[model samples]
Target: MASSFHQFLLLLCCSVWYLTHISQSQSSPLPNALLLPITKDATTLQYVTKILHGTPLVPVNLVVNLGGPLLWTDCSSRFASSSSRSIPSRSIKCSREKAHDLGTKRTTCPSSAQPCEVSTENGITRMATRGELVEDIVAVGSIAGSKATVDQFVFSCAPTFLLNGLASGAKGMMGLGRTPIALPSQISTALGTQQKFTICLSSSDGILVSDQGPHDSVFGPEISRSVTYTPLFSLQEHSIGVKSIKINGNRLSLNASLLSSNGGTKLSTIVPYTTMESTIYATFIKAYIQAAASMNMTRVASVAPFGLCFSSKGIDSKQLSLKVPAIDLVLQSEMVKWRILGRNSMVRVNDEVMCLGFLDGGLNPMTSIVLGGYQLEDIVLQFDLGTSMLGFSPSLLMWERSCSDFKFDSWPKYSL
Candidate 1:
């Protein structure tokens, strides 16, 4: 009888130990990659993410910008006074050395000036100015999960004009470029990880809740194996080399010399906010039109800004029998080809009209190929600062399943 009781007790103890081990493993910190659900406004292609800033933690929605080097938000009187959780911007002196290091011309400041004025250009044509720089606490990730908070975090308090123009509805912008003042640098230091981060923007329609990962972050270790990496050129610009571009299977006769950044030509791979040079855009449109023509597709009258438009009066974008040619952006190597699908390359302007998304960047004189955000929608972009490499893969959410049916726990199985 005593032996039977001892055996039962041992079995119970072993079961408890197994359960405890499983729980501890489940609670472990997530890998280096942090995945967040990016929210795109219905009217615009810009992607926004949420972050808590300041002492009491005011939730600020910021645009995830890859082309700028400064993290800033609107600090106007209205924004400061409205929220009880809002932390007022404090005054700080701007030194000549500091301005130079920030990649801007040194401005003359008087000794009596409490808030130093500094201005920097954004990814687009907008110029934002900060009247003062202040230190505050910033919390990243979710409040319920493994969150990182940095005390005495420094950022800009932009002028009313800049705030109103650039980030009107949103709080401000979160710059992801390779600058000392960028958000990635600050977050890397706070997390004690290498200065690295990845972005997996889902193009899936509808609202997406945070995934059920252990750390409650995006792009964790489970998805790492699926990423294909390419070397990143120009740290500040985050440009990658493009060997050639092919429409369908035929390659265009492009002048490689004109594409180079040599001499006075400012041509380079830029993740522009919007628009591309007329010359570059024209070439792509011509080839795309040719491909569509071959497919016996009829083109309707051109819209004002869009060079190409198709009548979708009878059929929806998904049901249209149009065979839009696949655009292959051959990167530094022939093996690395980034394919832009028809759904992404074409924009649905209205219920009856679908237009080419590429715009003429004739306004800007500099010869450049700007890869707008629309081209990158629904793609997972991984920026590795430590190795100066950019990795990308199609989002797993591209399957036929609805967004609500996505299971985060089974993400690894769907990785391409």
Candidate 2:
């Protein structure tokens, strides 16, 4: 089953690469980069974004999914747009062939004369419906300055049932996956920009910029000096080559094959934290505890999701961040590690307790390490489709700033 899941994941990502970006863009509506503000739910720790969609421009809250297939929203809302209209299935031919690849439940129109129907699924609950392929307006302020309104912005119109397990007030899911089905590729097709975007996430709210250049001010000195770029594994559930694990600069004794990105590790926004298989999780905990003993990090009763819990008593911490041992995810080489600091490595359960941000993914899970959103907070990630590289900056908090520092009310001079 695990092997099959890996095969399926690889297939999903592989399909994205061969498809053309501008298969559907008849004309350019908005030429500049698109900006979407992201917000994290306090309860779920999941990130969401708000967009002004439809004719009258009602605010639509959508969960940002790294591996989701397409942008889809609940059309059952009372504010369903006046200008929204369903289109024919043959016009764009988007996802028509890949519907079989999904292997999920779907609904389709019985006759060719009827409008196109789509199966919009909830990435969280997996609820699906034969939603309509509708076109409406999407208005947003661009990084190129001034607000722009996109006409005939196409998306799937799902029923209210697909909204289950979403963040409060969220009615849709905005897919940022690697394929043309995602926002970057869709915008690239329409606006003739690079099929790339940078997403900087804070604990609560973050920023998304499509086809944007680097902003040294927004990312600080670390972006130019310490940014690490890794070749992305084509999987929609994106994975990267993790050569080894290091705790406080000490390499852990582990099999190289176990840490392979081929099937062992993947990234996810849905999972609450970076998760490891039971055996690997045990080894990691042992190493962390051994390294932390000198710092007086006393082990306490394990938290429900987290295995390693330490008492906050006598420990130095400010707002759950401490100068703890750094957990490094060594990338292509020993020198190219993605250093995870205290703020990204540990979570404050309470004033009395703190826990490791990683979880255990059972004994024989499909993927060994599923990197989650908690570790991704306050970090800027640039997904470049042209180069097929994932550029990540060192934690923003390292420079005393967070992803929350970005001002979205207007455009800034982001250098190319």
Each prediction's whole-model lDDT (CA): 0.57, 0.74
Clash-forming residue pairs, model 2: 40-204
- Which whole-number lDDT from 0 to 100 does residue 238 have in model 1? 68
Instruction: Give one digit per residue, the lDDT tens place, for model 1 in 1-416.
Output: 99999999999999999999877656554433343445655444566666777656667777667756667777664244222232232323235213323544535534543444445444433664543555567766532344557775656777545644343477677777777667777676666667666554434332212223432233334444556777776646566666677888788777665444422121121232335556666887898889877865668888777878876554445633235677777777788887776655777777777777777767354435666766665555666777888777644434432222323442222111
Tens-digit lDDT string for candidate 2 (1-416): 99999999999887775454342221222335577777889987778887778778767778988877678888788485788877776555634423523543446544556676656678777677776777788766575455556676767878887887888888889887766556666677766678788888878768887754444434444454667899877556567888889998788888788777337567677777998887788889889999888666788998778888888787665433455778889888776778888888888889898899988888777777888889988888888878778888888776777888876435533210
| Model 2 residue 170 distance off true place after TM-score fit, in angstroms | 0.5
lDDT, candidate 2, at 288 = 95
TM-score of each: 0.75, 0.83
Residue 9, candidate 2: Cα error in Å is 62
- Whole-structure CA lDDT of model 2: 0.74
Candidate that would win on lDDT: 2
